[model samples]
Target chain A: MMEKYHIESYCRIKDQRISLNGATVFESAETNFLPFIKEAYKTLDTQYPKFFKMDALSKLALIASDLLLKNMTEKNIALVLSNRAASLDTDRRHQQSIEEADHYYPSPAVFVYTLPNICLGEISIKHRLFSENGFFVFEQFRADPLVDYADGLLKMQRAEKVLCGWMDLDNEKYDAFLYVVAKNGIFTHSKKKINQLYQTS
Target chain B: MNKVYLSYNNIVSGYGFDTAAAVEGIKKEDACLRQIHDKHLLPNHYCASKVASETLEEAYAQLRPKEAHTHLEKMLLVSLEKTIRASQLELTDRVGLIISTTKGNIDVLEPENPFPKSRAYLGQLGEKIRHFFGFQNEALVLSNACVSGVLAIAIAKRFILQGTYDEVFVVGGDLVTKFILSGFNAFQALSDEPCRPYDKNRSGINIGEVGTSVLVTKKTTHLAEESVVLLGEASCNDANHISGPSRTGEGLYRSIVAALAQSELNAGNIDCISAHGTATLFNDEMEAIAFNRSGLQNTPMNSLKGYFGHTLGASGLLETIIGMHSLHQNTLFASKGFQELGVSEPLNIIKKTTPKPIETFLKTASGFGGCNTAAIFKKVAEK
Candidate 1:
């Protein structure tokens, strides 16, 4: 059995505000996530020039995971994500290529991200987590299975620490939440203490 | 970690909404194939068995007004409505929601003139469902190819044991569209005749659509006592092929062995198996090898694709729900279109309806991208 881990950092994208650290970073969904990413990168004081301009969803996940990675070492970190739509932007592009019969078929580059789990692949490459990875989608977001999946990974010793949450971007309303979980003695973060971290908010 | 039981499960497939209806239709051994006569779509290239109208209409009538209009929306909303209502749960209750699907709202992406935006689709369908129920804690979605539904259940069990959420609602669904149909056609995997899983003359798969929901909880209430409990589950990447399963069934074998180990049960303990018989040659052959390697060769197994065609993402939950229904009813539905053994490895596939005391069962699926999952369920004594 794996020991329970509490959610330390909680963030929500609502009414154009990225609520985290008991403060509102941005007030518009269109621009809020990018600033949130910039702020996260600023906190870490490390910047990846390649990720400076990418899809908002991928950038958001990268910055968020960077913040999560700061809390602990990168040993045995896993990335698991859930989404209602896989990559709508990429899908839209692929659909366009397919529709344009006269032109060449869509490149595999764009076609690959059309699958939802590709984001996990992106996060894995960014974090260097070559271990266990998976993506699940349903009509709506649910937590029981995600928690169960994370715990299973821990119990199986597949990953010592996991970055798990939901990252969804379709039209304009993009939202993502993530938490880090590890063994009892592997890190200093306490499940109970972490629960209190959210209490002040 | 405490063991979280899968209390109640149900589905709305082409055959019907509930298990009784699906099983009854299966017992009759009816093939619900229909001709592709719609002028808007290609003709004669594709055919499928669809769920009856009454079942869907009845499901629609029961849904809340806000959830009943759209096609994909209605499929998910109605299934969840019945799932919650059957479980006797309040919408405000603290529970996790796990939605599993592949190509959700892909139909919304149609109309080539102006491409539809994905965010609007998510808000109208995905967020709408969350806000409708007020699930304030955590709502996650899983879209891992075709194994999404089965993976959803495995994740729910993990969360409950870790004490993330007391309960979870696992919903899986997808609507059929020209986009998917054409894609499958491109892959050359659609069978004109009714699909025959493990048959010597097996063709390809008949793509179908379905929606299924199961309420899983850690609380062992009386209702749970009367339901099937999920014992164990495991998932493994073939790492062998992207579009096809390994001929040796390496990943599938590992997944089955892991699941059996997690449940602390040997191969002999399993009473039956719900094979992922997509009717494709490579898929059936690989699954047969995996079963043989896992010592499940003799277990009476069957595939429900003959009854509902291939529901893709919903197949995992839909099949598991049907498996639970078999335990409760003590009647094993035969593989609808099975005739002769096809694969090299021999499997004991049920040809006729059989009544036996089913204590435990296994449900397995293999999808594109080298993904495979196996789940174990145990029948419990009704309290």
Candidate 2:
């Protein structure tokens, strides 16, 4: 049987309320990846130095995941992310190694970021989420699967709460959206209720 | 729960995208290995395996959106085109698009240009694909490591079962870039020769690129006779290491067990297993241990990496599609380039070609971040 889970809190970096829950905490199309990271970092009460450069997706995932970790303990939370670009920064660095024939050596540090789920690693290390963590990438973001995965995690009682979302970074733009899903009796959705939510959304 | 039927699946790889064509190539048993005669490219490396003809850039060029798109965009377009064509479904129909890839447009970053402030390029890829096909439903991207393709299919099945969308399109693709090649090379993970899975002489993995897509829908909708049904799937992380598998294969064992339990099938029920035979020593040994732990040691298994090299993110679906074709055609494929057993535990690696009434198949993959996934598929009876 599929487990029942509810969205505890949600955050988005889009311009409109695209979520079925009709919860729009933040909306912005003007903010770049760095500003968005800064905004999320500000909420986490973390200082972001200007020189601390990393991949946009990594920065976005770290900051957003930090916000999710801020309210809850880091013991059991699992980070599951879906995005289009796994790690663009590492990809660029690797490409440069080939383009420049003379100084062609791929950095293992940069190459490690090539995997899509590395953000989960970054988040886990920062928050000490030593539980389950994985990443999934697809052509686009489908809400049903996202919901199902969260529901599965909760149903299996793998974690008390799961932080899942779509975080994709490319070029000058980054979009990071996340929601915390839990099995609390107060906030829960049945299969029928989930269907209705999508129908109404 | 509603029954979800996996409909059409297609792949555009070095061996050719059409199912019949690829199957023929597979039957011919041609190894896609070439000796590096050109000293100019790299002198010391004696052997380097690559996808047949056409580099990733060339394949992207064939898609014809020469100017506006990046490598990821072009790959998506090609994969979507084949998938959409195979499904014969209207793009405007209320269906979801689930894309799986490792590195998206990360190749867009350059030293001189660096990543821009907006990072809009990533979002634009999804939005543009959605716009191009006019999909009314949501578009999702799954970016897990090598297991991403299978994970996408698993997610699509859940959505269809939960009635979130009547139909879902699952696409997985990745491109070979100098970044990945050089990185794998740096780690000494790249096999100088064609990958030899489960072979005593096996060295490491040879990187390859591929794109594959599948259409899944609720069971209420009738599909053609060739459509395959995804029975069950499970994914779990070892939390053991960031870049290697758990020697005990704890996460992998759990995932396989969960998947089998979800499908309500025992270890003996699976006719064949598609191992994530990257030919890497640790990966093969870990998989062997996991298979043994799952009590699937007797299952006839093979790895398609020798034919296509390690397709990273695309392998999950690419190999799944191959397994589906094998089941449909009733021919068990040989584990290409398997001459000797490398692991301590003896695995029933399919060497010579054989025929079996394959009603069910199991596909599994493990990646760098201790991620493991197993998906089971059963042959659908013709109505």
Candidate 3:
């Protein structure tokens, strides 16, 4: 028998809009992810200046995770996030930096974010969550694995809560959907409910 | 809950197409990292253990793979087929496949490459591996930096324990690409000479390439000649820095503690350790602190980096495969290229290939995401 878990909260950031629990919290029509995410960061009224130094992918993950984890009391929240690009956005930049010997200058600042899971690091640092942290890459958003893995963590007591997410960025197109699962919450955690919430954005 | 065993495995790397060749080279103290002057592989000279095209093609040709595959796909398929054939199992829906790589087909993104840019997407790479093998489930691609290989095993164990799949085929690899080379070079983390992990005068990492595979199943009958039952595994974040390790080794210490707790063992029980010694200043120092904090400063440990030159995504799994052999052989392989202790912690770094009675060992990996994973494996008694 599987243990019962529930989705405590969910958030989506796409098309310059931030929605939480099916309600809009922030919106921007800047048409560019850079300017739009900047507005979203300001909407939070947060001052973690490190956010600005991050790549677009990390910024998106940080803000989406921030919204759901801000008022949470649980300390052992494990993060299991998946994405499609897998840091290609920053990989391209790093590749271009040393592409030509004449103009070779690769900055460690940009090189560090080449891995997809660095956002997990940022979120872990921000929340002081030292629990299990994982990052996976999928062709498209799939909720079944996320639900199954997170549920297992809770069932095995690896973590009291799990923050499952799908955050992807490629060629200026990106979408982020994050949800927290706990023992008690609003909706029962299931693949069906997760997919519906992802679409509800 | 079901007990999971890492039964069948293979390691295809620069040493050769088989795991035995690698272990043999290590025992003989052969130079694993070599000088590569290939213009096609890279413009500058590199000290890496990259599988030559002829070596991979000759082995891959034996498989008669049809469609044109990238270098990485070839490496992965060659390694995957070895384990699949050794296991002699059906690839039904009960089986799951996981492809772990930090940057799969990343060279496709370079202008010098001819493959379609679509190959650079990690999903497309996963698709290639899955389609070649006809895995029942959509392949799971784990791309977490450095830790992906070991973490994939932990996930495979959870999958079986959760009744999600009966078996999982985990294949992990990463190329020594200009992309990664230049990136590490930018951080000034790439060593010009062969890496000397934990040596007093150590330099930095020698980026290498390898494709490794292992089967995780609940049945002991499927165990290979050299196999071990997984006792426990856990991953934790430092919550410290994304790129840098914690000064206190917090994440790694907690990971070992949690894993030991799960394994029902204490620090004193671990016979050996296969560490993630990338040979960087901070990484080695950090591991020293973490092992010291966990009361494992005196454990017989070796970093196989000198033997494999840090195979990135495959390093953890490749090293784990070697550790499985170490347990079976009752031998402790030398921590090659180590002369004196470098870190502040007192470590019993293996200095020579000595025969030792061992049963259990810990495999640990920490990566750029501040992600750390610790997995404990123990030998099964003879039937």
Measured against the true structure, the TM-scores of the candidates, in listed sequence, are 0.77, 0.79, 0.98
Evaluated at residue B13, the lDDT of candidate 1 is 69
Candidate 2 docking class: acceptable
State the TM-score of candidate 3 restricted to chain B.
0.98
Per-residue accuracy of model 3 over B54-95 as CA lDDT, tens digit each: 878988899888889999999999999999999999999999
Worst 10-residue lDDT window, candidate 1 chain B: B113-122
lDDT (10s digit) by residue, model 1, range B1-383? 57677776666766667656666777787755664654344334677766555667666776547533546656777777777877887655468887777777776666642434453244345555676567664456667777777888987887777666789898888766665665665567778788899999988888888778888888776464447778888776665544667888976897899889988999999999998998888999999999999999999999988888888778888888878878877878899789999999999999998888888899998776567789999887755
Clashes of each: 25, 28, 0
Give the alpha carbon lDDT tens digit for every residue of A1-201 in model 2.
654567666555543222323554444453455665555455446543421454566777766665556657536666777766556545665666656667777677667766768667556546655555666555555465566667766665556888887777766666677767776533464445444443343
- The candidate with the higher DockQ, 2 or 3, is 3
Best by DockQ: 3
Runs of candidate 2 exceeding 4 Å displacement: A1-78, A82-86, A94-98, A122-160, A166-179, A185-201, B35-79, B105-122, B220-222
Ranking by DockQ: 3, 2, 1
Q: Model 1 off-target regions past 4 Å?
A: A1-79, A83-85, A97-113, A118-132, A136-152, A155-201, B51-64, B112-116, B119-124, B224-226
TM-score of 1: 0.77
Runs in model 3 lying further than 4 Å from the true structure = B37-45
Task: Report the C-alpha lDDT of model 3 over A120-162, residue by residue, as the tens digit.
Answer: 9999888889988888899999998999999999999999999
lDDT of 3 at B157: 95
